[model samples]
Target: MHAPALALGALFSATAAIAHLACIAIGAPAYRVMGAGERMARAAQAGRLQPALVTLAVAAMLSAWAGYAVSGAGVVGPWPFTRPALVLITVLYLARGLAFALLKPLFPGNSATFWWISSGLCLLIGLVHLYGLLAAP
Candidate 1:
């Protein structure tokens, strides 16, 4: 059980690293080239990349659930901060999805603000997970 927790922690960390590389490294350059309108259109296009993004998002949610499970399994006692942080992270991700769905027009042109906001939310969520892993008893 402890090993699973540790492994899940490592999984979370690795996923975060990959996400940063994909979004910051590959995605940033791609966005700069395409511009926001094209980027939004590309995102809207049903293809390989969008499914991959959805998979990544689902994996992240599952990883968080695993961490919560591990914590509950007595490998780590309940940490005061972990649950709320996780909830906030979930909310941010949900909000991003909702923004994409409901506010599509807001995303398509010169919308660096959307990118920045989403990126910041992802970073905060990653940080919170790392903190939970480190602080877990």
Candidate 2:
């Protein structure tokens, strides 16, 4: 059970990271061509992808938490930073997702540095979770 959970967590984290990176890359071109207003309009019109991405992001965070909980239970010493860091990362991911959803309208254009930076952060957080999984017992 533990092994499977860890594997699943790693998989989720990696997938989330990759997906966000892709979004940032692809969205860049879209922003360049259409401008933020058009891009936001497209996102609003399409509807499906935004919600799906949000769902996946949330799932990734949840899986990371589950993995940490399982692995932490087995350890004897205090994992002072690991658990809190996981929580913080999860919050960051969630906050970014929410911002993307709500502020999609204000996105400015494909050149939006904010989007790129946020996406990169998402990938970094995912990598952090992956590192945690590797370090776990």
Best by TM-score: 1
Off by over 4 Å in 2: 1-9, 19-80, 110-137
Task: Give residue 110's error in model 2 in angstroms.
Answer: 4.9
- TM-score attained by model 2: 0.32
Query: What TM-score does candidate 1 get on C-alpha atoms?
Result: 0.34
Worst 10 residues of 1 by lDDT: 1-10
lDDT of each residue in 66-93, candidate 2, tens digit only: 4554454343333456566555655665
- Kindly give the stretch of ten consecutive residues in candidate 2 with the minimal lDDT sum: 28-37
Candidate 2 local distance difference test against the native: 0.51
Clashes of each: 0, 3
Cα distance off (Å), candidate 1, residue 134:
22
lDDT of each: 0.50, 0.51
